[model samples]
Target: AQSVAQPEDQVNVAEGNPLTVKCTYSVSGNPYLFWYVQYPNRGLQFLLKYITGDNLVKGSYGFEAEFNKSQTSFHLKKPSALVSDSALYFCAAVDNYGQNFVFGPGTRLSVLP
Candidate 1:
């Protein structure tokens, strides 16, 4: 069984400051991790993915994530926070054998100007 976890329910950041959303996972084999963002009443948009490669993977909108195999963690990060960057973020993991993707409880980001 594979599972994803987002420790924080919400993250608040000031505009122009850096922001981070933590995520962790449990899987039987090598994990395929992904990050997605969702807006109100809209479908989730893919932000980034870590299939294989460098430990640090960059993604859309200046977002990046670090994959730590030892810790089974993938934490999302942004260099600068924007008021418009406020949204719900989700961390997901694909089952090693199965094709299903299990998503973590979303983390809402609130950027205050």
Candidate 2:
């Protein structure tokens, strides 16, 4: 009853521009949301989380997300993208009781100079 889906496998953007990674979730109860980034064999780095209030949450590396209750979506966003920002982005959600954690396959972001 809890899961997430990222329709796109990759996103291409220009450096110094904005970038976004899409994510949507479904759960039976209130969810704890998180975003993580992994850079080629590196440990997953936490980006942000949405536990309760405030639909918009900011996180590490100039990244942020908007939690939309009506749409059941939490999308990652950044104003200015960097070539170094290119990496694998993952969206995850946990049940209130911590029973399960589901992750999207991943989105590979590429920023061109």
Candidate 3:
């Protein structure tokens, strides 16, 4: 079984400051991790992914995630937060045998200006 965990329900960060959203996963084998963002009343948009290679992976909109195999964690990071960056973020694990992906509950980020 593959699953993802998002420990926080919401995160608050000031504009121009760095922001981080945490995630952890459990899978049968090597995991394919992904990050996605969803705006209000909108569908989720792919932010980044970690298939293989370096532990550090960068993705869209100045977002990056570090894959820690030992910890089974893939935490998302942004160098500078923006008011517009406030949204719902999700962490997902791709099933190795199928095209299905199991997503985390979600983490809402609120950026204050």
User: Candidate 1 on 24-100: residue-level lDDT in tens?
Assistant: 99887888999999999999999999998899999999999999998999999999999999999999999667577
Encode model 3's per-residue lDDT on 36-108: one tens digit a residue.
Answer: 9999999999999999899999999999999999999999999999999999999999756655589999999
RMSD in Å for candidate 3, one decimal? 1.1
Question: Can you tell me which runs of candidate 3 are displaced by over 4 Å?
Answer: none
**Which is superior by TM-score, 1 or 2?**
2
Please provide TM-scores, in order, for all candidate models, with all chains considered together: 0.96, 0.96, 0.95
lDDT of each: 0.94, 0.93, 0.95
Superposition error at 61 for model 1 (Å): 0.5
Candidate 2: lDDT of 85? 94
Assess candidate 1 and give its lDDT.
0.94
Top candidate (TM-score): 2
Tens-digit lDDT track of model 2 for 1-113: 67899878999999999998999999768889999999998999999999999999999999999999889999999999999998999999988888789998889999999
Which stretches in model 2 have alpha-carbon errors above 4 Å? none
